[model samples]
Target chain A: MNKSLSMLENHPHIWRAREQSQQEERFSLGFDQLDEALNGGISTSGVIRIRTLTGIGELSLFKHVISKQRTHKMIAFVNPPGDIQAPWLATFGIDVKQVLIVKPSTEKESLWATEQCLKSTACHCVILWSNGVNTKESRRLQVAATHNDALCLLFTRPNRNSMHNSAALQTLPISLDLCLNYRQHALEVSVLKQRHGWPKDSIAIHNDWTPNNRAIKWAVEHNKVKRHVLHSVS
Target chain B: MLWAYLYFHQITLDTHEKASLSVGNNSRYDTKNEARHKRTGESANGQHQPGKTQTPAVIVYCEKTNHIVQRNNGALQQGIEIGHGLAQAGALCPQVCIIPFSEEDERLTLVQLAHRLYPFVSDIVIDTHNTLAIRLDNLVHYYGGHKELWSTITHELNLSKVSYHFATAWSIEAARILALNGVDNYECDRDNIKHRLSQCSLSLTALDKKTKEALTRVGIRHVHQLLAMPVHELGRRFDNNTISYLTALRGETFPHVTLFRPAEHFEHFTLLPFDVENTQHLTPFMEKLLGYLAHYLRARNLQTSTLCFQIDFREHPSTQLEIKSALPQSTVDSWLSLLTLRIENEVLPEPAVSITLRCDNFETIEGSNGDFFSNRFNEVAQKQLIGRLNAKLGEECTFQPKVSDTHQFETMSNAEISSSISASTFTSDIVPTFLFDTPKPLTQSTKVCFGPVRLHSEWWHETPRKRDYFIAQTLYGVRMLIFKDEDNQWWAQGLFS
Candidate 1:
């Protein structure tokens, strides 16, 4: 309506406080710390990097978010560390049949599989766990994900030294980067890089394995006495 | 030199009819079988019960005929002979299956017969459209004698299930004349062969109508009379071609026989003009090889699934590389994609020398069915992705995760995922995010966060195992599914990713 408002809408680099219709659809991670740290959670597409080791709260963190992606489409796991347990996927209320696993022997093949899945219209999301992805590979993955508007979450195992520090010296156009850590046997996650928001502090979720177990104190109290005793005879 | 002539009069028509009938075995083709049974004059199926009453006379339709060109014995029995018009044959026999013929199919049938007899006889000539002449002069010693060679040839022809009329004489032309004259017996003795050849009519000698009519007008209708005439005397009436034919047929002179060489896939080996360092420059050579391959595929009308090339080097052992297409393909483009993908990665150990390209199996091109009303989700693209993965990576590498109602985690993911997952109902028990391909022995000390859920193999299974499972977080905060077996050995199975 106004001259200033028209120029503001026309400007390419300007960020606007538009209506909900103009805003990208955000999927809440179902965890307050992750949603708040990710600034209204992740979208349906774009590259998100998770810098973590093999086993952490990464799967449980995005359990609810991944299920919200199109159910008719597929979710591909490229070079996953292990067999994606169907029962575990079932626990998240996602269709187990919608999961496709491509186990490429080499990192080059893993990147190819990731790009193929991202480019395919049938696949909605891709979870990649190749350690060889760098700035170029991450950018390539981002471009491939941008085609057909699919989500790609790359899980890179950070260096032993870099895992502790929030290394923000990045070189890729990554939307979000979260590093998972453990503190006193509880999972703590913090944002290493964010596209349009400030990186947030680490948040501690108190579930060790099962909910409300308080396993750190219980293991110290119970595991010490019965370390070597056998439970029952066959 | 002794020669044997094998004449397959019904090979082309029989093969054509059998091909269409066996392709689908429609009920409509049942009449063709009845015709063949009565034509072969054998009731192998016992369906020739009414004797030729309902047998359809099988005749070869001459595209638009002034004449009926070919016929089976039952057609002749019905008085619908060769040279009779279609109108005449139709009037004679109401139930007739007039099959059209082609020279290409006839040549292929002849080559197939030659292929069957190639191993037994060394010097066999594809003499004519329906006749094959085998030179027993040199091959008789190899197979012990003429009788053995003749018997082997007959045995092979019988095994091919083709109706063949064969005759042996001193020469190919004499043998052919005797064969077409119905002297289809293994007569190896020279006198008996001469007697049979002398009795053969001039009609079976492949002479033109004018020459035969002139010879017949002079009361010389048999081979004995033609052989009795002097070449110069016959030359006064007949041309030099007929004179040469008479001389050759009488065994006075030997005829040149071009021995048949079995067909092989066209192969090419090209040597580089100079030692090319980079593989990029060698595309010219690869182009030449692929061009030849395309011509070969087109010429033979064949589709091949696998192609290979042997790359020679200056010093290193020649490397053999194989390229495969996802489907049987005849075009050069389909193979070029795989070829570029294969050759781009191949690092030649030494400088180039030459390349030998080949197709091991030439598969006949088959028809493909296309879907007109497919869904909008781009299933073809999805399938192409799968096929590319199968071609580049391995087919076994891609899989869809499925859930089976089994306590043994190994067998659960292997089962194909059905549409309705009613077999799986998520329980409240703690489940790990990722299951290890194989369980490893637990060496590190870990704290169990949750308790023992007893899981074991079925009692009927071999080597049944029992274990108490727990959700354990490692010292580094990696949550895993661990178990203590009946042997009291601790093992880590998987992780909560």
Candidate 2:
């Protein structure tokens, strides 16, 4: 016997209305800057590709938003467990209760687990390590995530030579690496692509790590040594 | 336990918008009449007794459901906030609360509840993704046979405000058919099986009738009529295994059901994407995974005795490995520490692809009444230290017995070789403490920092060469790691990390 018929045959109106509403409402992260940049903070209901350079603070940005979520959200880290730095997360002020993690064995297993999580209503967000994700695999995950109204964040380490464009076609709205600066321990963020409005102007963010004594002292000493060398060269 | 599966008919705000008073604070609705008109049961002061008022309260009715699903509150379904039906319900009605019908939530709740309840039953098998089958034979007696179990289940559903339909039969197929057909209650016995089949509307396909003439020949007018035929003659007259199926459905023969699967290790975890570097991003996920693995093992009366870590680069296509313990233990701490160690020892050529901790060996563990002792058994400090090291290095750099192959180092092998222990089955076989397959040169003068240690293996092999290995330091202050070739030449390997 088909179970779906028993579940849906009697409630055509409800099922249809839910389907329609889910389609009409585009989900957002509620962060105006990031939301505007990526159509709306990663489609609340689809797989989203967010790419960044290796050294840039892309992971930090994703974590900051995910950490304080009051809503029930599950995040699956496809990246190797050690790749993410835990201490850096506390600095961003993320809460511990609202998130869940899943570590899959291989890339194939990782994708499978991710797809399973996306299909589950228990999870609100699925963040994947998209280092080797192809367009087809990415699309498959996006479809699964969207079907369940869960958001998918692809933390991509882009090719050093080529700009990553998988998200451009997969997501209705897209945000590309505009630009970021790690200057004197400070971070400045810029938007390169915006599917919504004129992208926000470049914003400067203070690096909390820089304010610590050890980091500050190290920066000061390093700068002094560089200055002395420059003077001697002149 | 008395069980009742109930669905709430209606609940809404327009009825109570005027209820401005807080639970103990001032009132929003001016008079009791306004509150009485709403479909909901209570008045602003919380003093209104149910079933005492002249008119019922308005409650939200589930628009999706039909049939006996709506036990009460039909009037609230219309725009009427205060309906007469709702006012009569008991404050804690077995059926009145608003329970969201989410498939995800239902599945999650079922799994979690099942985990907690396994000890009470002989076995419990959950069919996930709607395809996996579960056999309930052994568990039948534990729940006090079919009648007692179904009644107990019905009681639980009433408490949770959930509605479900189920049955017990000789075959899983028959049970599934009965449950899906809205036949909520059942007792699978020899005498009642035919009566149940007779009550069902069996289509031609369900009965496997070839054509209208074939169906009429047996005078099998209805599903029940066909079920009365003899099994052997029915098969001879018809095609395929239809007769066998009929017999099974009638309880003459028992059908096979899928066996329950128990996890080797369990985990329960949640993860959120924080900034890339914070390893804590994985803590919740780790915790959840461990919980699932633990619970899975417990269901099978087993425990994970050994674990291995698989760490990947987030940005690059490289993998690292780490080994945690020689012995098996089922706890979050052990899994976490092994993960940490793997993380520290390996370097991500890129950030990280993903991290996985797999516990392969499970030892039978007696069910313990209290979990408090298990929580205190593992060390948090060791796990934390391992996690730190993993964050600084990579997950793969650390090596343990299970994850790493204990193969002899050969001439072609690098300093770090994947372990072969995965394929080796010798539980007690002891090989040499160290076996180097790659023989170094007997002599080298690049800067002899340390003396040579002679090495030999596979003495039976005809082409085996006797060689000396030296740990060296170069004049440039760089450690000149050189190996002597069997031909008497020296090759220098790079400085280690």
Number of the predicted model whose DockQ against the real structure is largest: 1
- Every model's TM-score: 0.43, 0.29
Backbone collision tally, model 1 = 0
| TM-score attained by chain A of model 1 | 0.76
Query: Chain B vs. true chain B: TM-score for each candidate?
Result: 0.49, 0.38
Q: Compared with the true structure, what per-residue lDDT tens digits does model 1 show for residues B129-220?
A: 87788888888788897778777888888766678788888888899998887777987789999887888778888788999998889899
- What lDDT score is found at residue B235 in candidate 2? 72
Best by lDDT: 1
A189-231: candidate 2 lDDT, tens digit per residue: 5555443334455555543321113455677788775345544
The global C-alpha lDDT for each of the candidates, from Candidate 1 onward, is 0.73, 0.45
